[model samples]
Target: AILNSCEYGEGWATDTYEKALKDDAEYLTTEQQAMIKAQHALLKADHDKVKSMHDTLAEIA
Candidate 1:
């Protein structure tokens, strides 16, 4: 259940960021851009961690 929530949150954040980048980049303040980039980086890190966990579980099984 927690994993599902994380996946949903990540998907929503990714979609929102992509839309902002595609549709509003030119209008965004520098600080806003930096914040979005930081969010993206954190999301990517979470994804990588999940993938690593899956790989380790696969190896164990």
Candidate 2:
């Protein structure tokens, strides 16, 4: 749900800004960019931890 919210927020931001410009360029505010970056970092950390656990389990099994 948290990831979904981030995705939805990104989509909304793109629609609200890019649609006005009619271009593929991003126009995120500083705060929006920071928020997205933080979310991505969290997701990456979670993924890395899960992968490490899976690898450890596989080694034991």
Best by lDDT: 1
- lDDT of each residue in 1-61, candidate 1, tens digit only: 4555666677677778878877999999999999988888788778667656666766897
For all predictions, the C-alpha RMSD in Å is: 2.5, 8.3
Write the residue-wise lDDT of candidate 2 on 1-61 in tens digits: 4544555565565455444344422676667666666665565566556556656766897
lDDT of 1 at 7: 61
- Quote the RMSD, in angstroms, for model 1: 2.5
What are the models' TM-scores? Answer: 0.63, 0.55
| Candidate 1: residue 7 Cα off by (Å) | 4.9
Worst 10 residues of 2 by lDDT: 16-25
